[model samples]
Target chain A: MDIDNISELIPQPVPLRDIDDSPGPCCMSFGFDLNPLIQSIEKVGLINPPLLKRDNQGSITIIIGYRRIKALKSLKADGAGCRILSGDDILPVECLLLNLYDNLAVRKLNDVEKGMVLARLIPWIKTLEIVEHYMPFLGLPSNRATLSSYLKIEEEMEVRVRESIACGQLSLRNAIMLLDIDSISRSSIIDLISNLKLTVNQQRQLIEYTVDLSHIQGRPIPDFLDDQSIKEINSDTRMNNPQKGRALIRYLRMKRYPSVSKAERKFKKMISRLNLGKTVKIDHSPSFESPYYRLEVLFKDGQSLREKLENFMREDIDSLRDPWKKKK
Target chain B: MDEGVQKYKSTKSILLQLKDIPVRAEKDDGPEEVACVSNELKRDMGKDTMHLVSYQGEFLKPCPGTKEYICCGYQILNVGTNCPLDCSYCILQTYFNRPNLRVHVNLEEQLGQVFQTIDSDPDKIFRVGTGEFTDSLALDPIIRWSETILRGFSERKNTVLELKTKTANTAGLLGSKYRDRIIVSWSLNSPFISCREEHGAVSLTRRLECARECQSEGFTIGFHFDPIIQHSNWMDEYRKTVDLMDKYIEPEGIIWMSLGSFRFMPALKPIIRRRHPETSILDGEFVLGLDGKMRYFKPIRMELYAFLNELLHQWHPDLGLYLCMESNEVWQESMGWRPETSEGLGNYLDERVRNFFG
Candidate 1:
């Protein structure tokens, strides 16, 4: 059906209570804010009447303008003008396409909304069709992996996690990581993420460390996160949220990689004993994967360089070895 | 002997064998079906199915080795892709886009061309193996790959065909009269890893027993400790496997034994986690190497390789111990000597081949 001809339909008054305001089959909106839409309807009366389909039993379902109807309902309007289509006149897929195209023309759908659209399209069209045409049309990467991630978002994620993703508080990549755990663990992790206000990178590190530690320690994620040290870090008054996040990640990393952490601590202790001055420093490769260590010296002139080198060479220069190596 | 003969006759040809197996033959239409399906569905559907297609790619190619590490210049014999054994740490999980136990049905017809390539370079010892892409003997019971290609390789002088496997399906090898220039190798790991991670594989004791049987039948065997994982009491656990080797057979008949720590591409982490959630293989402290693969920390890898090298050398001094794809520092520190470069490692293995077979 040509959706352009729908404008020719006459408007009728439908009682707000009679229409099902819940998200219908064609609705792709989720974790959306109604304030802007509500303000718009308050400033100017409903500019375009919401499209609704009435069944033979007189039950009404909103096809478009779900947000508009929701705003009107909040405004306590008893009835509003709506463009009604007989349920038999239009197909469900056609209604979905109409809403999709209408929404695409006016605004961009958030990640959760895109997931909702894909979830709805999955029942109507083939996955190949959605991947080739609808995914790109919805501004998502046209790949099965990306499609699978979005489907999980819509189908498996809890509402609070979806809200976190939609509001840009949590990243979609991090949210996908939470899907591997149970709902309770996911909720607790989401709570920690929100409370700490972690950056995307920190969120990823937290989830990775938590998951790896859980697997290694043979404990669930909630049980792992409920350790006394973690709780102490979270409740520490001296540290801010970002500090708490970093401290929690450090704690988990130490637990996950005990040998690496111990080696790092040993190196730190040895370096402190050497008393390398402000201008002189020593460093090792990340994780000590490289067999060599670096000695850096900063000087103002050639004479200063020589003096600093001579000074650095005097006190236990031969003691520097692989941190994991025992003294012979 | 009659039942063995009948079983061989039933699966002698690919077309004849298809009658016995439960398979759905789909028409070749397009790439849409394979490309668009979810990985979970693809894995479930492809696990038990076999697709017989005439492979059009090069039948013989060099192992794709990175320059950052010393690779033992082995060549890959493209007999098939994918494996029946679903080890949790298998790199084949994310390596292939299409799924199935794809056996190159035209391998018999293409043997002459592969031999021609090796014959063209007579001076270059082609250390070819069929276990790189798929297990060399996992499907040998039905596909009869051994019956078709064993005689050709047995006749060649400059090459050795290594049929590597984790299975005890050596009936085909023993059934064939040809034994020269064929190395029957088994991928050995700790019994804990074998039982927990390697799904559908035989037990460690069974594998060692098969190795002993092959040795008694005048077949020189090999063992690989590639992907030695770090778990609880890993040192003691791995010792159990080496001790089992001591009980089964003499180390004097063994050829090369390789030691390699677990490494994988970054993309495979999620796949492993999803496919095998209870796996302890990913619990090590991993760092990105120059080759862009995540490997155990340098110290951890050295520890593992060093322990195994000492243990295996103690079993037999001439077991031809080597590290597969390790740097010069790692070689010197772990194995107590350095191959220094890929060519150097290749020459070392070639020398071992000459000493054993010549």
Candidate 2:
């Protein structure tokens, strides 16, 4: 804990191969590109030496600067200067805290990296302690639900999905929905989402509709996604990606709610048959949940409004009954 | 000793009797534990557990009704919170933060306060019920709530106590001599829904048989066709229930029957999905209503109500049919008339009370 030393601890030139470079228990870096660090080291020869901890077996582990070592190795550098500490001198938790603080001071961690930090802390600290002290330090809301979500993400999600989330391709909310299903179905849905390049709203609808359909139809989500109509929408050449995404959602929604869709179609047909002028319009509430229909006339003045109302009164408005109702 | 146990003389006997019943040590696959989101709360909702607490709130409170719809103006006698039954569509899944079968052991001591409130308004008819927060008779065998509070309400002229339940455990009520102003109501649903959705509930036949037994004993009865769902051949399914009612129950003895469609707050949707994964109750087309709960579309609701109205009216036109938490438009369209407001609906039900008990 003595930081104001006259001269720092001795820095030694350690062979890169001697150190275990894989993300150790202390590492919180994930879904990162090493090329930028490699290019930086290539230009400015490693200014701050990485931290290493040597065990009793004389094996070295990188306590900090995991990305630096990975970058150095990628650049074919055989050795780098690193400060060493005996593993007995510092506890594993202290080492983790050192790495965490070191990373926090420089750059913000991605969602996956934050999960990694919380996961690493779980073994050494109580949940409440973590929620109170460390969660705020990691810039997360101090709640058990959020903590459970992060733990599940780190412990359950595959590398590809985590990578997608870390790189800003998929949202954390949508990824949580994927966790409720099996891995095969999750992968298929993830692939479709990526290929279609769905927006956040579209991604949510896609997952919700797919899950509801699977439960209703008593089939796996992958099987439902493999339907011929869905594939046709995906492979349609004339439609763009956004159009296909919309068409896919429309197809699934129609399948999920057949009665509502039929009623909507009938209502639209009936309204078109009325053919009131372009200035006058009739609109039903969302899903036709309300009993009353709205009438709007875009008139320029009182005389124009009166004329439109007279025209509306002349139409057979009583035909505008509940679409599902039969004619008397 | 807690005040709840010290004040109520029967709490000691109830606790002694509860010790004889074997409770599951671990949580079961029940709806109460499944609906819990937090681990702390889940642990609190122990399997088949009971808690004796002196309820601190008012013993009698008005039913919390929204102004967006017609309300029956029923008074809720807070006998307890939570229930022994685990019906899939229960709103109590998320209604309370605390969990367990909480029996207000001080209910007997607080009856005078409740009566005072009712007696203060001499002209107002208190259509009181105990089944709003919990089932009326599900735990009656052990708790003996009927023995404590039945006579008090039965002796009152301006008040009627209705014990609504899905269980056929009416032994305590039948053993009692208080039947003048007491209405034993059964929540009736279609047989398909009864078997599939109403977990731990008595069968439709058994319930109807109980009603017949109660009516034969000179007790006026009521029925609620609430949450009338739309399913495959729903008309036929409900008609089957009606036919069974025709067999076991007399139409003349029934006082009032309520018809309501399936509606719930949005928060209960996920809880229902999590608890009842294989349930088909969520397959209907629902839209947000004016009161912020998800309900079936207007036309669908009209279809359900109109169909049941015709069937019930055919059974007995004087069965005093009414709709729960519905709009004036729905009442007019479905039942051929409208109560127009909550007060109007309350007056109608109060009239029913007077006609039955006066």
Q: Model 1: per-residue lDDT, tens digit, B1-358?
A: 1112222232247646567676554554433343466667445537676776567799899999998888999999998888999999898887545577877777777888999998998998888899999999999987888789899888888988899999999999999998988999999999889899999889999999999999999998999998899988999999999999999978988889998899999888887887887789999998788788999888899999999989888888889889988889899989889988899999999998888888
The DockQ of each candidate is: 0.43, 0.38
> Candidate 2's residue-wise lDDT over A115-182, tens digit each?
99999999998877988899999899887667878888999999988988999888998887787778
Write the residue-wise lDDT of candidate 1 on A83-142 in tens digits.
999888898888999899989999999999999999899889888899999999999888
> Would candidate 2 be rated incorrect, acceptable, medium or high by CAPRI criteria?
acceptable
- State residue A286's C-alpha deviation in candidate 1, in Å: 2.4
User: For residues B1-358, what per-residue lDDT tens digits would candidate 2 score against the true structure?
Assistant: 2332644766776867778765333322223322124654543343266766677789999999998889999999999888878888888877435577878888888899999998999899999999999999999998898899999899888899999999999999999999998999999999888899998899999999999999999899999998888888899999999999999988988989999999999778766776678788888877788889989887789889999999989988899899999998889989999998999999998999898888
**Which pairs, if any, clash in model 2?**
none
Prediction 1 global C-alpha lDDT: 0.87
| Local error of candidate 2 at residue B87 (angstroms) | 1.7
Q: In terms of TM-score, which candidate is strongest? A: 1
TM-score of chain B of each: 0.94, 0.93
Model 2 clashing-pair count:
0
